[model samples]
Target: MAKCTAVIDIGSNSMRMAVFQKTSRFSFHILHEVKSSVRLSEHAYKNDGYLQSATMNRTAQAIGEFLSIARSFGARKLLCVATSALRDAPNAQEFISRIQREHNLSIKVIDGEKEAYLGAIACANLLPKMDALTVDVGGGSSEFAVLRNGKVETLYSLNIGTVRIKELFFDRNDLAGAVAYIDNALSALPDFGIDTFIGIGGTFRALTRALMKKENYPLKKLHAYTTDDVRFQTFAEQILQAGPKKLKSLYIKTDRFDTIKPGTLILQRILKYTCAQKLVCSGVGVREGVFLNDLLRNSAASFPANYNPSVRYLLDTYATHSDHGIQCSHLVKRLFDLLQAPLNLKADYRHDLVIAAKLLPIGIGIRYYAYQRHSHNIAMSGLDYALSHTQIVLISHLLLFKKGSRSSSLIPRAGYGTLLPDNATVDALSAILWLSHILLAARINADTLSVHYIDGKLEIRGKHLYLAKEQLRNIVLPKNLIVVFQE
Candidate 1:
């Protein structure tokens, strides 16, 4: 039986409910998600730091609606976690009681330490393998986690947040003071080793989307999107100088004007503090964290280190089984190993080529004609949890090449080709996949199929096979590689 769970995370700035369907023992995919900008922290920190009765009532209603929608998905398990705003309110118990008494729901208000750890769990598992200083910046507080070697070495939940900063520091023209506040508040944080800043929460996502628009980024996917400090600073300056009207002109949602600039300003401080050059925006945060925690409850693993790819899990859940993918994967690797000598391709491509081969048949399972093209789209935008943005593009291109990807339109130009390595990189890898594909489709069984540098001419010594017009296209390799097949 398929087990599904919903995690409803009530944060200071927004309320989110994510439904995660367990696709495998260790991995799950988002079945459904709904978020509301309830801004539970609105005025909750004023004076005595009590959740205004009206604010609590409104957020409670949002929670009830989210729970109802979650129930519709047949979610057998529901976990609700509230952070920051609720934790700070002196009358938090009163609000919690109201949730239980009115909606018969139990809300676990976790502490700052747990909140930071959960954010780490979501990031370490979903993003690529990289050491980063991760920050889950919320409306009420920001959680900093130092991720090194797939583990969070240090974490802190500071009271510095977008909403808090806006309230206390936005009106002050002294930008230096705001940064000084951040530095002072986070004085206890240890010296950071990694330079990559993994920015989470809605504000960072909003900033990322806005930057994507400014730069006309092509991928259109938000997770794992990276931007350099210079580009982001340009937007940050505009956001800082612009009012709500100007932000709208820049394509930033007007609703975010009240907080986006402040958030970006805080981000600037974080960058300076860590001297990080890159900001990897993660769409996953505390809500996804809660769902992952529950999903891995009984498992021995506590992190993303050994988790199965969410792509593999989703394919399994959809019952898209393909033994051909497995076969192609093996055949492609063998060809790469045998051909790399004369091809002069790097060993780094082997893993990517294998992934490309394994995921090829998934598109055919969807439709037969131009299935490779469909596979290309899925690989670029659909698969999740493991491969980096670079890997995704390479795999997508390999899939395209596997099906004779040669035309100008067929080139999978992600990051406008700049993000992709030089043509020689994919060219050689694609050549290998293309040849392996032909042999697999033709069922050409050869006792000896190998590449040999014979008399300075690449020779194919395989079973004297007839090459068709299009078959020759498969043999076209990178300008640098010279190879002859022999069987």
Candidate 2:
């Protein structure tokens, strides 16, 4: 049975609800998601640190709709959080009281420190292995978390955001003013280890959109977006000079265009000050963090022996289909190992090849006409957690090769950036995964088959390999590759 949990995040600029259905040990499928731009912080300055009546009413209506959806989905638990604007508002208690009385929902206004900590937890669990500085930019504030070896080292929240910055320095067209404001805000905080910065929230999303347009990125996945200093600076300058009217022309979303410039400026300032080479865009944020924290607490209390929700979910999802995937992966690896000496490929190439082998059969549900294409589409579209963009592209390309398709034309060019693999490596890995899939289809229990080099020839040995007579007619082995089946 699938257990569902709903998390509603009320931000200064928008309100979002994410419903996660527990599928397996560490796997949760996103059941439903809804976002509405309420702009609660629009009048924070005018109202002198209080939420305005109009914004509060709209927010209440949105939350009511979100609650209905959550109940319909049969969510076991619901977590509602208000950040930045609501937390800072002088009349926040009044707003909370009204929400409880009218909607029967209690709103927890979390402090900036807790917000930053939760964001870090989500990133740590999502990526698992990375030295990341998680940054969440909201309407009224921005949370920065420095993580080392998947553990939070330090965190800080600043009074800087798309809406907050716009309110403070929107009138000042001078680039120096924006830079100074950003520098001053960041300088006060204790030093955070400078490494790869993981950007979250609206500003980061807008920056990614601008980069995607500039590069003509074909893939819509936001999992692994890496931008160098030069590219970041170039886009920042363009946004600064063109203003909102010109930004709209570039197809930037209307709701975000007005704030994008300010947001970009903030990102650029942080990057320049930190002297980081690249920015990684993370789709996960405060809402995910909130849900994750709740799960962790529950897991600790209820199942002390089996703690860690993320790991549990991952194990459960993989248990269903991992055996076949691992079998194919082993065969693919053995084949690649045998050919590695001859192909002279680097060590990193093996990772891409193995991932391709695992994901090849994932598209069996779709029609076989272009099932490889469908598999490739699913991989490039982004996985639920942690898998990077480059990893997805490589896996997608490998799947494409299984169908004897040209990966260059099918895979998107822009999302890869500088990490794009060499053509020779791509070709070799594709061939290896395709052959493994072909061999596996013939014998479901063919786990003993091993690929090894015998006098410069690739040979497959095992009882199943010897018994499979259809290999001669159905299988098309790569040229110059000799396959010897041993009885």
lDDT of each: 0.75, 0.73
Tens-digit per-residue lDDT, 1-487, candidate 2: 2379999999988899999887754457678999999998886865587788899889889889999999999998888988998888898898899999998998999999899988887777665357978888888888988888667778789988877777667745555776787899989776565668888887887778778777877556665577777887787778777856788766578788768778878888887777777677787888878877876664531223313343334334433443555577788877887888787777767866776666665555455567667766665553545556666667766666423344444445555534457765666666667667667755464466766788867777666543354544344444556766666
Stretches > 4 Å off in candidate 1: 171-180, 298-308, 317-321, 401-409, 412-415, 442-487
Best by lDDT: 1
Candidate 2 Cα misplacement greater than 4 A, ranges: 171-179, 191-193, 296-323, 368-370, 382-384, 401-420, 466-469, 472-480
Q: What are the RMSD figures for all models against the true structure? A: 3.4, 4.0
- Report the C-alpha lDDT of model 1 over 321-423, residue by residue, as the tens digit: 6466666667777777766776777898898888777777667767878887777877776766656677777777667643334423356445445556667
Which consecutive 10 residues in model 2 have the weakest lDDT in total?
A: 300-309
TM-score of each: 0.89, 0.87
